[model samples]
Target: MDGWHDAADRFGVPRTDAVLLALNLYGLQTRLGARVRLQVSVPVGAQARTIVIAAGRPDSPFTLADSGQLFAGAELVGAAVRTDVDDAVSGYLRCWDGTAWRAATINPASRSKCTGCAPCPTSLEPTADPRLDTEDELHLLLDGLRQQLPHGGSLRDLHEITVSTACYESEDAALEAMMVLRKVLRSRRIDARIVLLSSVVRSREAFRWLAEHVGPFGLFLTADCVTRRNLILKKTKADLLPELMPALLADAREAGLDTSFTYIVGLDSTKDMEPFLSAMLPQVTLFPSLQVFQAHTPVMDGLHTPEADEFSYFLNARRIVESVMVDAANNLVPEPWRCYRSLWYESYAGQPLEGPRR
Candidate 1:
């Protein structure tokens, strides 16, 4: 109850009946035996307020104001939400498209380890159209992205593009969409680097296919936590992520693609930064393009506000990563564009560290 009001207050809107109904409907649909999060906030580049509903347990209370303090952790679950919070919050109670959970069961209360081989559903369903599939939606998305650019440049003038989905239907479907997008962009002489944000790249073949098909593309893999308990909290089957990520990166490298690992700090249950960093920094050095993101609890994810200490943990972790990089190598060129605190290596004085060439 307090969490609900906090969300409303953070959004600077009254807790009207309409908002309550939207939140309740979203909660019920994604409940699925675990607590569903109802995030009420205004998104960037939008006029009206928005409510994003996703499946997960809220371990803490979070508000719109806490966005800056949010750290990425293993408990993060991507959502497929129905747009609500317009005059009438329509499509509020839409069920999980079963896309995000195709790799694992939608359960956060489980105590056992996931098999890691949960079969992904075969049927490719489009929860969000145009951008998720269809050439028309892609164009619309491009138009929207272009509108945000300064001086109003077209898609061809853009240097980079990130194509993401709540959950990719499959590797094949993702490849197909990429191919279509590539063809369209090529026709216009638009050769922007395309980055993919999806969950279907666990297989070696998927990595190979991405390397072969997508031109100047990269995959964003978020390793929120290394512990099994945190992985369970995030409702992910990636328990072996720490072990498998190296192999995955090797596969991507072999295929001539860049794979960037994103680490989120400040999970409620996670306190120590050293263990996570100790295990992770080596990989960061290997990849050299690793990203570290701050975490916040989204109301829709049913997560709690990060503790004050959690944010501090994130700050300290960032400092430590930078320090480690400096010690490990001499030349640490800052890549603020990659991430605010990211370092792009030019050369290690003698070792010759190679950053992402593309």
Candidate 2:
């Protein structure tokens, strides 16, 4: 309940804040397997005032003010909710539709505070000494993602892996970590691709070496924001990123390795986003892939959190890329953009690599 309330504060009315509120409340009441029903009635005349009906049995129906108007017939059967919101309204409804929760649908206009109900896993956190080695923690995190793959299946089927290595202080350590990952996958007979975080522009030798050995495989570079000034000052202090990204993408392509860049939304407050799009869209066409930014786990002191609208803008940009470049070639799907070696690597390897790359 508190979690939903906090989120509602951020997203204004006429949005999915209410749906999230209802879902969270329903989850709490039914945690013990007790069936719960929430009926929302909006008065025809009173646009602001709403009536929420919480009925569990014939004996009682609790009615409350719909200040949030979040409860609108989100019910739970013996175990699950009945009037589930469809995909169209799912984003506005905030309810998880049996498969997974949609973070993009969350309204950023609401005024709710995040409760951090689930803290990031300890293994994903930075080390205590800051200067201390993170190889052990990194392995633990990677192993965790590997454990998530379907049991008894080959690793090549697992198409995606998200890593958090972009924030690491040591690029060498990051490269070494990937090497260890490659060794592990080969041992297991799983074929998979890799998305590396952090600016590898300064470490051309390392990246070149990676291209020589792992380059035949897939590689994704994460830059969230497009401009060098903003990325260097606000997001990451690496100035060489802007120049390095294009070069790296070109190098990867020349090396026969599939490559792409990651762009985050809502990083800047400027209204005219066309310039950013202009610089990135061309790359999306020329490059192998373009991963749009979505609000995932918060990082860099919460610098990555984007307004819901901004996130939507990023998604729309991806659509533009798909329609213009990918659709033209019928390569809209990510699989086609992946490196040829990814197929062989995952087939010969086992388990998926996890965590952001540096």
| Highest lDDT scorer | 1
Residues 67-115 of candidate 1: C-alpha lDDT, one tens digit per residue:
3221123222222232322111101111112221001111111112223
List model 2 lDDT by residue over 1-358, tens digit each.
Answer: 3433344344322223233223322232212112222232222122121112122322221222223222233421111212221111101211122232211111111112211212112222222212212445434434544454344532344443323234433667667756665555555553455445445433557657776665334455555454434433433333444545656565655555555665444444334333444444444322433322222123422443344333233333433444445334533233311321111111111222222111
Task: Report how far off residue 137 is in candidate 1 (Å).
Answer: 2.3
Count of backbone clashes, every candidate in sequence: 20, 36
Report the Cα lDDT for residue 331, model 2: 36
TM-score, structure 2 vs. true: 0.45
